[model samples]
Target: MSKVTLAIGGMSCASCALSIEAEVKKIDGVLESSVNYATETAYFEISDDKLLDVIKSKVQSLGFSTSDELHTPTEKTSGENYLVKFYISIALSLLLFSLAMWPLMGWPNREVNWFIQLVLCLPIWAWIGLKFQKSLVRFFLTGKSNMNTLIGLGTTAAFVYSAIITVFNDASVSFGLTQKVYFEAVGFIISFVYLGNYFEERAKRKTKEALNSLFKLSSKKALVEIDSKFVEVDIDEVQKGSVLRVKPGEKFPVDGKILRGSSLIDESMITGEPVPLLKSSDDLVYSGTINGDSVIEYIATKVGKDTFLSQIIAFVEQAQGSRPKIQQFADRISSIFTPVVIAISVLTFICWFFLGPEPFWGNAISNMIAVLVIACPCALGLATPTAVVVATGRASLKGILIGGGEIIERSEKIDTIIFDKTGTITEGRPSVVEALFNNDEETTLMDIASIEQFSEHPLSNAIVKYSQDRKIPLSEPDSFEIVKGKGIIASIDEREYVIGNKLLLEESSIEFQQNLTPNEIGSYVFVACNGVHCATLVVGDKIKSTSKSVIDELKFLGIETWMITGDNEIVAEYVAKELGIEHFVANALPLEKSSYVESLQAKGKNVAMIGDGVNDAPALAKANVSMAMGTGADVAMNASDVTLVKGDLSKAIDFLKLSHGTMKIIKQNLFLSMVYNSLLIPIAAGVLVIFDGPMMPPVLASIAMGLSSISVVSNSLRIKTII
Candidate 1:
C-alpha cells in the first residue's frame, strides 16, 4: 500500500473533513484516512490495489479537488458538510444534557443510578470519540505527538478506573471517584470540541469561498456536432477535434479554436480584461468564457481535468499544503505544548494521590481527565488559521488573492517595497494626456481619431480610446506602411499622411511645431495630413490614484518605499518624488531589476517587489515577497505570491496590516489557552476541593474551554478591522 497525502479543497468545518474521511473510507483497499478542516488536507493510506488515479477520481466526484501534483500547498474551500457534523454533535450533547440532569432533578431516577448516567452519555462518547481513538493509536504507534493522545489517556483512565472502583467499593465509602463516575464529562470532552470544530469549520468554509467561486465558472456540457446534427454531451465525454456549437450568451464548454463562426468573447475570466474580444476562424477560445453575439462553432481541444478550471482548483488546493514561511514558530509551540501538558496532567494525579486529602484513584482519575479536557489545543490549532482565513477573505473582497500564509507573514516584515514603473505605479496604458489642434474646425476630433486608428501603437491606441469616447468611427486607409521606431505612412485616396514622433517626422523631412508643454510627461507624436499639420497626439501614462496612498501608508507604518523603472530618469524621478518614495533605480532592464532585488536581499533587507510586466517575472520571483497587479503579464502573476484583482495599489496596505494582526492574534490565543489550562485543570481535580470547596469538573471544563475559545475568537475578530 502507498501512503500519499493530498491537500483537499472545499473543506470548511471539522465535520466536512469527517465527511470526506467517511467517503475516502468507502474506497476499496483504503486502510485509513483522515481530513483536517483547519489544515485543509486529507491523509490516507491506500493499498496497492487502489491506484492514485482511482483515488483522485473518486475524490473529484464529490465536488472537491486534490492537490497532489503542486510543488507547493495552498488553502482550499471548506464547504457545508462540516456544519452538519457540528449540528449533530450539538444535538447529541443537548440530548445527553437532558438525560443526565433528569436524575439530579428527581425525574424518576433510582435517586442517582450510576448506570443511568453511563447509558445517557455512552453514545456520544463512543460515537464522537471513535476518531480520537484512531488518532491515539496512530500516536502510540508512531511515537509522534498529537493532542489526541492526551485526551485518550485522560478519558479512558477516568472511565475504566471509575467503573472498577464502583464495581468493587460499597456505597458510603467516601472515595471520590468510586462514589460518582462523571461519565458524562468523558462524553462532553468529545462533544464540546466537536462543537468548536464545527463552528471553526463553518467559519473556515465561508472564508475560502473565493476558490469555490472561481471553480464554478466551468461549463458542464457542450453542444457537439454529431452526424451533421447538433447534440449536447457532457464536457468530459467530448474529445479533441469535436466541433462544438456554442450559442450566443453561452459559456464556452472547452478550450478550442473558432472553426466555423465568429463572435465577441468575454475573456475576462482569465485575463481580467474588461473588453470583449472579437473571434474569427482560428481565433483561440478558452473554456468557460462567455460568448456575446453570433453562434460559434469551435473545435474542442481540451476538456475535464485538462481544462483551466481544474488547473486553478488544483493550484488552490496544492498551495494550501506548501510549507508556510512563518509556521515554524507554530510547529515549535504545538510540539512543546503537547508533552508539557501531558507531564502536568500526570503530575496532577500523583500530587493529589500523595499530598492532598482526596489522594485516592477516584479523584486522581477525575483530575487527569480534567487536565486533558482543559488543556486542549483548540485555541493553539485555531490561532493561525482563523486569522489567515479572516485576512484572506477580506483581501478577496478588495480583489486581492494571497496564496501562501508565509507571504502575509513575511510581507509584514518587509521594510522596503520596490515598484516597477509601467503597470505597477503607472496605469501602463498610454492615453492622450493632452491634445492640441491649431484649427477651430468642428470635425478635428473625428479627423484625428479616425487617422490614428489606422495605425496600432501606444500613441495610436491612446487616440483611439479617446476618440471612441467622443463617438468617432475610424475609416479604412489605403497603402498603410509602419516605419520602425518612427511614424506611420498611409494614403487617403491620393494624398499622403504622415503620423509619428518628432524624430520620425524629422526623418521624413516633414516639419512640425514643438509647442509641447514642458510639465507634461509622455511621448510626443505629431500627425500631418495631406501635407498640412493637423493635430498633435501626446501619449503618456498617469500614476495610479492609489500609488501615492500606498507609499504614504507604508512610510507611516515605518516601512521604506522605493522604485525601479525602465523609463527615462526624469520620468522615473517624477513618479518617485510625487509618491514620496525616496529611493529609485532609473533605466533598469529585466535583469537589472532582478539583480537589484537580489542585492537588497544579500544586504539583509527583506524586500517586496511589485510589478506587472513579463520582464518583471524574474524580479518578482527573486524578491522576499512579491505582488502582481491584476493587469500584469501572466508569467509575472504566476511568479508572484499575491495578486491584486483590480490592478490597483491600495491592497498592498491591506496585506501588511492583515498579516500583522493575524500573528498578533495567534500569540494572544496561545497565551490565553496556555494560561487557562495551567490554572484551571489542577483546580478541577480537587487540588483545593478540600479547602476552597470541591470545584465541579463540568463547570471548570466549561470555563476553561470558554476562555480558550473566547480569546481565540476575539483575537481572530481583531483582523476584521484590517480592511
Candidate 2:
C-alpha cells in the first residue's frame, strides 16, 4: 500500500472533516483515511496508485480542495484578501444600518428612502457576500452542505424578502405592511461573519507557529568541502558523504558524524537538555544543533527529509492533525445539525405566520431569518479541535511529543505513576565507584576488564571503561560465553574467569571469604578467577537530580509514585529512599512490571507508566498513559503515548500540567458553545414574540453567532500561554 498526505482547504469544522473522510473511504482500493480538521489535512493509504485522482475528485465533490505540495510551516494563508473584503463590508454595513435607523430620527422622504436602502444593500449582499453565494451554489450542484450553506440560506432570506418589498412599492400602504426592510440585517450578517472568520484565521495561524519555529532551526546553507576546497552551498545540494565545515556557535546543516575536530554541541532545543554535550571524532551530530567553541568538520550522514530534524517536524505535524475521541462526538453533532436547523426555521416561520402578528408575512420572514442566522454549528465543530491543535503545538515546542490528543485526556486521569528504575529514575549507565580485591588489585582489575571487554552489557562496558580510564593493560579473553541473566564467562591467559552479578559468582562455587559492605548505593559486580573468589566491584548508577523533585511534585498533586526495577532489593530500596519514593518493587522483570501496573489499575487507580521505552514497553502499553524517553529505544517510543525528548523526569510533571490546562480550556469552550446555542435558538424562534418583546432580527442574530465562534477560537489560543 502507498500513503499520501494532502493539505486540504475550505474545511470549516469537524463535520466537514468527517464528510470528506467518509467520501474518501468510499473510493475503490482505499485502505484507510484520516482527516483532521485542526491541521486541515488528510492522510490516506491506498492499495492502488490509480486511486489518488478518484479520491481527490471525491473530496472536491464535498466542497473541499486538496494539494500534494507540502507547505512551509510559516506559509501565510489567503487571509489578506479576506481582511480587505471584511473592511469594506463592515464600512458599508454600518452605513446601511445608519440609514435604516434614519426614520427613527424623524428624517423626511420615508417613501423614497426605502429604495436607497435597497440600492445600498444590493452591493453588500451581491458583491461582499458573493463567496457564501458561490458556496451555496456549489452545495446545490454537489449535494454537499457545510457552514457556508447555513450562512448562505440565512443571508439570502433577508436579502430576497427585502428586495420583493422594494419592488412592490404600493404594498407598503395597501396591506399596512411594517415598512421595515431587512437590508441592514443582510449587511451585518455578511460583515460580522467575515470579521469572525478573519479573526479565526489569525488565531489558527498562531497555533502553527510552533511547527514554524522548528523549521527555522535548520540552516539554509552549509559550507561543504568540494575537491579539497570549502564551498558554500544550499543544504539540499550537500549530499550524503559530503564533508561539512561547522564553525563555532553555528547550527549543523544535517545529521553527520565528526571527521576532524571535537566540540561541545548545544542540542538543548532538540533534546531539551540545557547543558551542551561534549562531542569528539566519530560522534553523531544532528541537524539544527549548534556547534560550540571549537570548529569541526563532519561527514554528512543524512540530508533533507531523512534528517532527524525533518523527521521531528513531520512527527509534530502528524500529531497536531490527530483527532481525539471528543472530536468524534463533536463531528457527529454537527453533521445532523444543519438539516434540523433548516426544518426548525421552516417550522418557526409557519408558527409566526399563522399566529397573532398583524404584519404576519414580514414578522414570519424576519423570525425565520433569525432562526437560520443564529443556528450556526461552527462553534460546536470548533470547540474541541481548536484547543487540541494549540495544545499539541505548544507541547512540541517544549520538547514534548504527544502522539494524539487522546493522551491529554488520559494524562488528566492518571492517579498513580510507575517508573522503570534504570535509565528512567537513575541514569541507565552504571559506573565503578569502588573496587574490593582478594588478590593483586591491578591483576584482578586487568583480568576482569579482559573478560568484560569481550561483552557488550552495560556493566561490562563500564568495567572496561574504568580499566581503560585507570591506564590498566588488558589481555584478550578466549572462548567467551554469556551466562544467561547472570553475566559472562571466559578463558583469559588459560585461566577460567567469571564476571557478572552476585548470582554468577554464587553458582560458580566461588565462596566469599568475608561479606563485602558497600559504603554507597550501587549495583555490585563480582569477579571470580580459577573458581576462587577474587574481587567485588561496586558499580553505582547515578540517580537523576530531578527525579526527587518530580516525585515530590507528584505527591503535592495528590499522585502516588512507585519505582519498579530488576535490581536487587538493597539497590532498589536505596534508590527509592534517595528519591523519597514511598513504594517500590524490587527484582521485577519486564512482565512482572507490566503485571504490577495492571494490579494497580485493577485496584481502581489510573496508572501512568514511565520507562526508558525499551525494556519497559510491556508496562508502558498496559498503563493508562505511557511516557518514553526520546533517548531510549525506538520500540519504547513507539509504544509510548508521550515522549519526553530530553529524557528528563521533570518534564512528565509538565506533561500532566499541560494536559490539565488543555482539558480545562476545552471544557470552557464547550460550555460557552452550548450556553450560546441553548439560550439563543429559542429567542431566534420567536418564543418571546407572544410577550410583545422585540423580535430577534437576523442582523443581531448573525452578530451573536459570529461572536460565539470567535470566542471559542480565542479561548483555544489561550492554551499556548499555559505554563
lDDT of 1 by residue, 1-723 (tens): 777878776542233455567777988888987665545667678887446677788777654578864223233332243345446656655665465556656776533455555565555556656655654554455454444555555556555654554455554255565344546556555654454444445434332443444445668788999999999888778998899999999999888888887776866445332235668899988876788777999888777777754555454444333333344344445435667767887897897777655437656666776666556555555556566667777788878887645466777678888988877888877777778776743366665656667654446778789888767666666678876456687775565778876777677776665553334667777877677677676678878888888888888888877798777788788888888897998877565777898788788898998988655655776677888898766556666778888897888887777777766766676677667666776675556766777655464455455567667777778777867
Give the lowest summed-lDDT range of ten residues in model 1. Answer: 70-79
TM-score to native of every candidate shown: 0.64, 0.56
Candidate 2 lands at a TM-score of: 0.56
Identify the leading candidate in terms of lDDT.
2
lDDT of 2: 0.75
TM-score of 1: 0.64
RMSD, candidate 2, Å: 11.9
Positional deviation of 504 in candidate 2, in angstroms? 37
lDDT against the true structure, per candidate, is 0.66, 0.75
The alpha-carbon deviation from the true structure for residue 662 of candidate 1, after best TM-score superposition, in angstroms, is: 4.6
Kindly state the number of residue pairs that clash in model 2: 1
Kindly give the stretch of ten consecutive residues in candidate 2 with the minimal lDDT sum.
267-276
